[model samples]
Target: MVRWQVNLTVLWLGQFLVMGGMTMIVPFLPLYLQELGMKDPHEVATWAGLIFAGNFVTSFLFQPIWGGLADRYGRKVMLLRSGFGMAIVMTLMGFAGNAWQLLILRMVNGTISGYAPAAVALMSTNTPKEKMGFAMGTLQSGAVAGTILGPFIGGLLAEWIGYRYIFYITGILLFAASVLTLLLVKEKFNVKEASAKPKISVIQAFGQLRHVRQLPSLYGVTLLIQFAMLSTMPLMPLFVAELHGQTAGLAFFAGLVGSITGFSNMFASPILGKLSDRIGPERILGICLAGAAVLFIPQAFVHNVWQLFAARFGLGIFMGGLLPTVNALIRKYTPEGMESRSYSFNTSALSLGNMLGPVVGGAISGYFNIREIFILSTILLFINSLWVYKTLLVRKTSIEVNFEDERPR
Candidate 1:
């Protein structure tokens, strides 16, 4: 097997483990809080948001710094840093005596979160650019598959084995991921380049990206997509109940609505990725954004559980391509040697969206209702489609194409 192929395999499993381990706590976060002695539903809800938001706050701050370090040293080092750091944090969360302790531990976990971005940077640079869409798409499928499975397993284990032990199991999974990445993933770092290049400051790294054509717009789309997709998450169960109207197995149906997207996304990513390689990621991104916008509207008008599920599934098919398409575009336009820094900055954008989306969604849902959140998401995605068309797809005949055009290079 080729070296890049081996790296792709390890990174796939690595992504799967890290994502799965990270999400394993999702199903029972409220239960864990109960274990920490919060009986008030309001207090538990408040603490849940706090614990989750704190991590993203630190992660958004540190991603660029880690990205710069990845470029100076190697992306593989960043992967190990993230994998081991998360393993330690996951292990420590199991021992927290209070909600504050767990929240603080989550804050600390954010400081060292780089494994997935590191893997992307390494894979983007190592794999031939010609096949980058397929590679990134395949990598995305692993993470999507993990997301689909993690919550199910977490819920089951929380019932059978308990939440604390689930933390230990998640820690073990992450540690195994670190071990796999360390043993199987090889980096072709140039000793001369490492020694010769001066250390780059985080501010300097941001400046480097600003100069790349289409990169700034692509980064903007990262935030847009994440925010649009996640905005409805906090209200999903309530929406399900609202639709099902006191039906039996409400939680089960809600869980299916929540996760159905990942299943379709996992199946669609590689296929759309190959299509992107031929038609250009910019085109695929535009089409998907428009399709997602249209699909999200039906979700707002759904009269039955099946209608909701069908909408989410169709939405997922489009969601599958948006990020992979952006990643491919980012890889194509990013200047050589700046791949890690660029991807890291993009990851930071994603973290910001993850933090902001729920807040905005919660606010909108509070002000209006759960259904309005879908309309808001639909509007955001529609605006994003227009942005893609203007920034990435329009013809530019007068000036040199530079990084703007994805025409056969």
Candidate 2:
């Protein structure tokens, strides 16, 4: 147990270092574009949307491919590949001379950035069943902490040096993280001969949908929960800009707000995971989802910058528990030999939600007001939560029977 804990901790640290380095570029990318001669706010906004969207688009598209390869080739190799690949691309991004150059690099970075998912697959494979929730939660908290710190560090670095220097620094940190992973992580590829064959196609990886009848309640709840969780993501920076402006200081403030929210999640995740273990993950998820919806609605009404900040911070507390609980619930349903494939589908679903959230939010904000975007997001989340309550929690018996039959009975 101690050895496994140590290994998991080291893996968690590696994930933290990588995430911290990678996220540093996010807060400064728009500012970097403006400096590169795209001076129009609309263009900057469009490019920013593209930059954010590009990562998810590629990451979402390629996740199952990477997951299948990891299952066959080995997760440790994939981890190394992700870390080194990202380091190389990120370093090259510092040399980008034009907006198109930077955009291209971002797209490449997105295509190759699978370190988090790799680490997730590794940790999930190694950890014992009873402690899976705790282990996954702890790992997620590390990521949340890194996400929180990245912007603060990047903002300061961008101010002191330049946005280009921020990229260089991130690249260096990522390279260092890769080195750490190579030195510490020991791979024990547990592939059975029967399962090693190419039975699962990349398309079938997304075909967890076909098994909806197998675990209808769990699947439905998970989809709704993810949708509710991601609905507010795109509106965040826009909200910050409305309260502040497009200045570097405002950008830093926006980053700070984002970081603080993520930082709060760092503390809240493990506690929520433990609570889920004691009570029930579904119940905890229901509470958190509803709380996040209620908390987020008030952001639309916040009159001042401080009020907006407070609302986001409060929202973070409820939202923090979401990812770990979702992962735990998914783990509950995953069969023993298919952990990698199950996680791939799970992450793909999350990526799908992420892809839709920003596009929808951006369109709504463009068409109406930013505040109206929040209102729309809030209403959608509320409806999603209510749907989960009706469909899943209300039909517990049917779910139990399905689970019983799916097991080797």
Candidate 3:
């Protein structure tokens, strides 16, 4: 048990470091593009949206492919590959001469962004069923911590030196993470199974969606939860700018908002996760959904930076529980062999939300006021929370009944 715990801890640490390094680039990317000759606000905004959307588009498209490969080959190998590939791509991004080059590199980075999925697969496979929630929650805390620290540090570096340096530093850190993964992660490859006929086709691989459909309420609730959670994302920078009126360093203010949210996630995620373990993931999830909705509504009204910070911090507390609870609920519904597929599908849903959230936010902000964007987000979240309660919490169907209902009558 101790050995297993140690192994999990190491994997978690590797994930934390990699995520920290990778996300650090996000807050600085727009500023970097501006420095690289695109000075127009509209151009910078468009490029920023493209950069953000591009990552998710590629990630969503390739996640299932990586999952299938992991199932066939091994999870650890995929982890190493993802880390190494991401490191190289991220480094090359630093040398990009134009916005187009940087956009291409971002797409490449997204294509190889399987480290977290791989790590989750590896950890879930090894962890005891009884302690799965606890373990996953603990792992999530580490990643959140990285997100909290990354932006602040990256923003500072970008301000003091240059934005390109942020990418270089992130690349080096990712490379170091890859090295650590290669050295420490151990997988028992199945020689006999490797020689056998392939068990699943790429199309058949997508058949895993059937499993999720069996738990429609769970799946729907999860999707809504993610949609609600991410709806506020694109407007964050704009919101910060409004709060920090006349601020000299807009990049720093953006970083400050990112860091505050991260800090809240860092502190709140584990506690909510542990609470989920104690009280139950479903109840915790429902409560978080409602709480986040309430908190986020107030964000649209904040007049000062400190007020925005407080609202975001409060929202982060409840929002932090969402992913872990969703994971736990999905685990409860999915079978062992299908866990990887289930997680991959969940990730794809998140990617879809990532794609839609920004587009929705950007569109709303483009035509209407940014504050209206938050109001719309609040409405979406409220609807999402109610949907979760009605679909998952209120329904008391067995897995088999749910499955049967989802099939042809």
lDDT of 2 by residue, 1-409 (tens): 4755876777778778887887787767889988888989998988887876777777777777877777777777888898999999989989999888877887788788788777877777777767777777788888888877886788789899999988888888888888888887775675575246767787775465346432344444445545554555666767788777676788667657666677677888888877777777767777887887788787879877788778778877877777777677666666554556566666666667777765665566667776776676577667766765775566655778889999994
Question: After aligning candidate 1 to the native by TM-score, how far in Å is the CA of 161 from where it should be?
Answer: 1.1
Give the per-residue Cα lDDT of candidate 1 at 45: 87
Of 2 and 3, the candidate ahead on lDDT is 3
Give the clashing pairs for model 2.
Answer: none
| Tens digits of lDDT, candidate 3, 128-229 | 666766767777778878877777788679889888877888888888888888887766556367536367755686665564543455555556655655
Listed in order, each prediction's TM-score against the native is: 0.95, 0.84, 0.85
How do all the candidates rank in terms of lDDT, highest first? Answer: 1, 3, 2
- Model 3 vs. true fold: TM: 0.85
- By lDDT, who's the top model here? 1
Better of 1 and 2 by TM-score: 1
Q: Candidate 3's error at 224, in angstroms?
A: 4.1
> Of 2 and 3, which scores higher on TM-score?
3
Evaluated with TM-score, which candidate comes out highest? 1
